[model samples]
Structures are given as C-alpha cells and as structure tokens.
Target: MNMLHTQLLQLKPDDIIVEPSVTPLLAGRYRTKRRRQTLHTHKQFDDWVTVSGVQKRRQRSCKVCALLRGDRNKSYHTTFFCEDCSHGEAKCFLYPKARREYNGKRVVLQRPGKVGRRKKTRRELLQDGGAADDEEDD
Candidate 1:
C-alpha cells in the first residue's frame, strides 16, 4: 500500500494527457472553418430626401457675372476670370491700380497709407496751447 501511494504521488497529470496530432490535414481543417458572408441580390434605394437636401444648398455665385463660380466652363487656366463680364478674360473693375514708387533707378510697389490722426511735435503742441493742459496737474 505504501509503494502504490508513492507511485501515485510521483505520477503527473501531463503523463496521462492525450495531445492532438500536429499534422497539416488537422491544421488546414481548422483554418478553413471561417464564416462566409451572406449574399443579397436585391437592389438598394438611396434616401432622396438626404440627397436632395445636400443638392438644395446654394453654392457661392460670382459678384460680377452673378453665375455659379464653380462652373467648369467658366474657369481659367492660369488665373480666375468671369465669363459674362470680361468675355472670360482675367479683368476686374473693382480692383484698384497699384501705386508705383520711383526711387532713382528702381521702381517699387507702394502700399496704401493708413488714414489716422497725425502726431504733433513739442513746438506744435506748445503753439496750440496743449502744453498748458499738461502743466495744469504739475
């Protein structure tokens, strides 16, 4: 009874375990057992409300020509041009002519001057009685 108990204690569960065969046939069988997609041969209809709603949103029209700016026929190759106004040529009446400054030999483009209140000098301020206003607190 002591010898049988010692032998049972020494025996492992892994020693009696049955492992499956690692052959290609058994491996291929498991690999091919995936679920297939179901086929539906009926035609699906699109929601017309959503489609027309997207189409109903108006696109930006040209200010000069008053036509759709996104039109493919009205587009130019190098620059944008209004078809109805300047006969599809690049011309804008609203655009102001750029002022050119001549400095000796070089001619440079001058930006428009800002229209604001000009700063007066100390002499000019004193002449205008502005110095009395500052001296009043002192």
Candidate 2:
C-alpha cells in the first residue's frame, strides 16, 4: 500500500540493484533464487488526504481574507468580515476543507455542557450553617 512496497514488486529476477559506494551481495541474484519481486499497485497516488471529525467554528477566523484585507479585515462568527461589511470579504473559517483562504484566524465554535450541573454535597451544606439537627441536638 505504501510507496516503498510498490517499487520493490517491480524488480525482475535478473535486474541489478545499484549502490553508489559499494556492491551488496543481496543485490545480485543467486542461481537457486527463482522468485523475484515485481512492482504493482492497486490504488492511485493522491496529493491530498482528508480526515473526518467534529470541530469548533466560532473560535477561529478566516486567514486568506486576512492577508487580502490586511489591517482592514475583522474575523467573527466563524468567518472574516471585510472593511465594507460586505459578503465578498466573508470566507470559510475552517481550513483545508474549503477552497477559500489557506491562512486565517481560527474561531472555535462554542460547545455547551454535555452533562447536568453538579449538586451541592452534605459537607458544603453543613459548612453553609445548615447542619443536620439530629446529630447536633444529640
């Protein structure tokens, strides 16, 4: 699957493996060695790869429009806003996923609490002067 493995499979039995400094014994084929590796690949090469995941959007700003606008551009709402406040200046805050700007401020989207709020403990209630009457009276 990797580049190196594909190259090794392409070699023929009689093919010579060249070394710059010195020759290696493994380079030459032996009489008993009938099998040789040949080059083959099932998948095409790619210049770019993508991963899937959830991300925050409101915390970062767009980078491409930043370069274009220089000091005039302001980033907010997970995007860049031009000096004129027009839609043209606004761009995708996320990088690599979209074709807009390659560089920019990152606006992370705010995430709400996934769990319920914690309740006060007995110790906290006692400290606040609400001790149990049963123990105190005894």
Best by TM-score: 1
Name the weakest run of 10 consecutive residues (lDDT summed) in model 1.
94-103
Give TM per candidate: 0.20, 0.16
Alpha-carbon error at 82 in model 2, in Å? 16
TM-score of 1: 0.20
Candidate 1 lDDT over 53-105, as tens digits, reads: 46432222233322212233342212232333443334432112222322122
- List CA RMSD, all candidates: 23.8, 20.9
Q: lDDT winner among the candidates? A: 2
Per-residue lDDT tens digits for candidate 2, residues 2-115, read: 888988898787797766887556644563666555322212112233436544323444454343333444643232222322335343342223333222443344332333
lDDT of 2 at 61: 47
Error of 2 at 108 (Å): 15
Deviation of model 1 at 50, angstroms: 49
